[model samples]
Target: MRPRYMLSGNISPPSSAMALYSTPRSDKRTLQRNRRWPGSSATRSSATSTLSRSGSMLSSCLQCRTSTCRRISISERVICLILHSRFSFSKYMSESHLSLRVCYRKIAVDEGGLPSWANSKYRKYTPGKPHPNAIEYLVAVDENFFAFNITWPQDDSKKYDDPEKKLDQMRAYVTYFVEYDKQQLPRSKQPYIFYIDSRWASLKLMELLHENQLFGVLSCGENMRPKVLWSWIKADLAKYDWWSIGLPRLSANLVCVRTKDKVYLKILTNYCALKEIQYKKRKRKFPMTEFYVAACDVQKEYNAFKCKVDQLNKAVLEYFRLSRYLDDKVTFTQFFIHLFTVQSWTYYNACTGRSLSQLEYRVLVLQELAVEILPPPQPSVLAVHWPKHMGGRTHNCQYSPCRNNCTYFCIACEKWGCLKCLEKAHLNG
Candidate 1:
């Protein structure tokens, strides 16, 4: 007996050579005119009349020949011929067979009149530079606070994990001011000094200073020993001729000013010696009381400078309010106002009762305020509309995965539809 094998359902062999050879040739005419435009109505009517005559002739020939070949109709032949001529077969059929046509007329506008597409009237505003005499200071402060939990023992494993990130944030905080200084300061003059809190007195910060070549001062907490800080100051002084030391006084902080001015330093330290020399030359006429009155006038001028800062802050806040968008969800205006106020307080603490000269105090106050009111953050997202085929992609589509084949959200129709569907349903009709 012959061996038998089980067969799977619907198992079939591939097509034979004769089957492949005998397959009908694809209509090359169909491929040629896939996207061709339909001819005018008069041309289409003429072609149709010719096709009818050909049909009659073809039918009579087929009846006489009695051939086994499949008959080709006149309508089909005329379609192939029309398509080969590169005229739109589909559009011709729609116009002649279906009886419909659409034509658009262009409109022209005279000079000085706006175009049809003109929409908005308001122009964009560009900001200008502030005055040179304007005082501005860039200030950076960092505070370390311990995290607590209800659990018995502390979770110290996460301590080092956050330091790098925190350091990056602090560095970014100072970078903004550095950019501002570069833009506003003249190339000839040295950059105004940057001020930071004591926690940043790390080797990491020093490395950053060396890398960026920045001139700045680091103010430590009151508990930092004076002798140790003095040693650090002397070492820093050797490298940089200009340095300022902030020390705790009876009620407030005192910043001892020093510079590379050898002549001025000697004159300040030995005023009596200078006076004695001046007496010998018979040039010491003015009493010391006159100098005291002059100093009091300088104090009055400093008070006027403080008033100007207050005025500037108020003006900046008002400008911020004007620029705020009506639909803004964030309280950015209020945030900026609070920021300016905090900056003013820091300036007051750094300068008030610190024996700062009138000119130095004014400069510091203005610099601090400038850094505070550095332009507001730009809008997070912008809306845009682009013409089809312009290579623009929609961001917020109704169909995210596009399983249902929606293209994008339509605000007008309140629905989502693919481009093909939209063209067929709305544009075609």
Candidate 2:
């Protein structure tokens, strides 16, 4: 026979802590229900006698005494006692029925990985994609200048002390470049394109563009120059004259080889607005804003926004006056040269409204002309110059063109290199 396995414990009512205290009669009812009922007096007495014997056996088992042991095989009685104990123990469980229900509901809802139902309520809705034809092509360019600063030592005794201006100047140059790029590029492109160096600031600008949904192509180092990217854009826009002019113009001056070229400047203006507004008191009592310049290269120039009969005649006369300077029938190069020269003069006059000395005016004109003719100097040519014989044997010469050196050099030139020394040297020669 197989060895019998049974749970060993005294079958007793649950403790006061576990029992249902609110219902005082529950324990009595449980006991009554578990007991056998409606028996003859002799049978009852026999049952009582059996209960007494079983109770004594249970007490002996608790004390680990085996002298008087008894076995009872009533499975129903055991099951009923377990049920009563469970009901009594449940009273001590802390969670209320309502709280348990809520907990189960939460578990059921979160069984899946994500709350897809909540997504509909919390997530933003996006519209359908735009029609291909409705989208417009846009291009933007940003440019900036880089320069260095220099500072001079204040004390004569501290020969080794260097100035702090050079670093400050470089900082300013970079700051200006960043500001110009931000102000110009966004306005120029539809969504906007950003052009910048491979420096940290440039990377930051690109990030800003990306966040704005502005499309742009980044070029590192020398590739970041505006001329290279803008040339292709201008060529593309050449076919659409009106649309080209309507495009925004970047405020940052592009560093282009052809930027100063007469031909390129003309081409650029063809798609850009180059206007010289001259204000004059008019007789008509019109809004001051209405008196502003209304002009375009292709269309007839007029005083008013609309084309009126008398206004058209005046516009025709003005157009003829302006066109006389332009090469209407010349080759592309000659035409561009003429346009570039005339526009340059006009822009100069507008910018410097006051009368200037002949020398000053000539210098300004030459500078403008040179911009078209001269290419940027090579790095070697533009490199900082240091005097080889500055200090006695060229040893410890401070050959690194310090702030004091540059200022001293400029002053020496302006003062004509020490008049007394120059005269003595001349006499010796």
Candidate 3:
């Protein structure tokens, strides 16, 4: 079987694909778009996209002779993949096919900020001169920026950053996206969204941004704030598109309408189920205009997900309720009986791909009948996570194979949790 890797439309790392949710007060669910990480659509125009004169390193690797060793890139970030005659790893690895690391880096003097690599004259090229760790640089760097961390124990408290290298890392980051965009971006295009995940990273980038006079859309949540953050950065806020809701917040999927005041955060619409309890309890503080439209869009998405969940559950229940007769040994069409006698939904059935016995399968099927409705577990967006660095009371979230990957919990309605089922349970909920 061809190996499959998860990819997101934005510039984020592959494994960190987040299934974002709109807060209870807001009806919309969203996977906030990353402006720097343009989806597959952006790759069509390579001339204006990532690479400069060196062009894409991975694509350029096509000229590699069989069994030959060739280094790719015009910057410090480099990756080597072996190609063999029998298998088409080459076919599988293409610009269209998303890899989790930086496939290409730029080598422009204006974009390059760091001291030269050995091949600085002929070094690996990366996206603009972003810090190799910049969200956009990481996207272009590899198909999996943190693949080692996917199976990383959620409970383990391992620190990845070294304090000494922080300034250097931050410099690389600003060079990647901010500097890269300044060079290749068309004058007509608005800046792409660069999500700031931590307070320190935000502080460092904002500081570098003012000094360099570069611009991009920066989105972040509440925990990212320090008391003096906005106070100092507010002056240069207009230099770029700084999209945020000052409240301690989660990333929303729907495109947010930008405003100067916090009143937009309080605004809700008639269509949202939350309108009655959250917004109507008090007098309206802000005038509702475009936000009224955004609220409606959120509701529309939520309702669609809600309807899909209800329909799937009803079908699964009905299928099991009526499948008994066909499951019998003496049935004419025993194929489906075998298919479901396995009890596809059960944890063991899915793992072993078999039931311990027919009687055991029957018991498992009956268990499904007892539930009036089974709401699958929901996984929260990876962006709005309860950090792995901080230990929590809930070890493994209410999802998965005891991998200790449970890091998310919903205190809003006491519904849905952790990473495993975030998309199914949380989105539908």
Best by lDDT: 3
As for candidate 2, its clashing pairs are 149-165, 149-166, 150-165, 150-166, 151-165, 260-372
Ranking by lDDT: 3, 1, 2
lDDT of 3 by residue, 178-239 (tens): 44444552322433222222212333444343344333222223333242333332333321
Best by TM-score: 3
* Cα shift from native, residue 394, model 3 (Å): 84
Residues 45-116 of candidate 1 have per-residue lDDT tens digits of 111122121111111100010111113322232223324345323432322222111100110000011011
TM-score for all models, in order of appearance:
0.20, 0.14, 0.21
Clashes of each: 7, 6, 44
Q: Candidate 1 — what's its lDDT? A: 0.26
- The residue-level lDDT of candidate 1 at 154 comes to 16
Candidate 2 structure lDDT: 0.23
Tens digits of per-residue lDDT for model 2, 1-429? 110111123222224312211111222221121112112121111111221211111110011101111121122112222243332323333332111110000000000011111212211221221221111111111111100111111112221112121122222222322333344422322232222212211223333333333332222232222324434323422211211111112111111112211322211111112222233333345454334332222121111211222222222123222222333233223422322333223223332344554345446556644664695765654233322223322122122232122211112222222233334434554
Q: What does the lDDT read for residue 256 in candidate 3?
A: 28
Q: Rank the candidates by TM-score, best first.
A: 3, 1, 2
User: Which clashing pairs does model 1 show?
Assistant: 135-366, 135-367, 136-366, 136-367, 136-368, 137-367, 137-368
Pairing residues by index, what is the TM-score of model 3?
A: 0.21
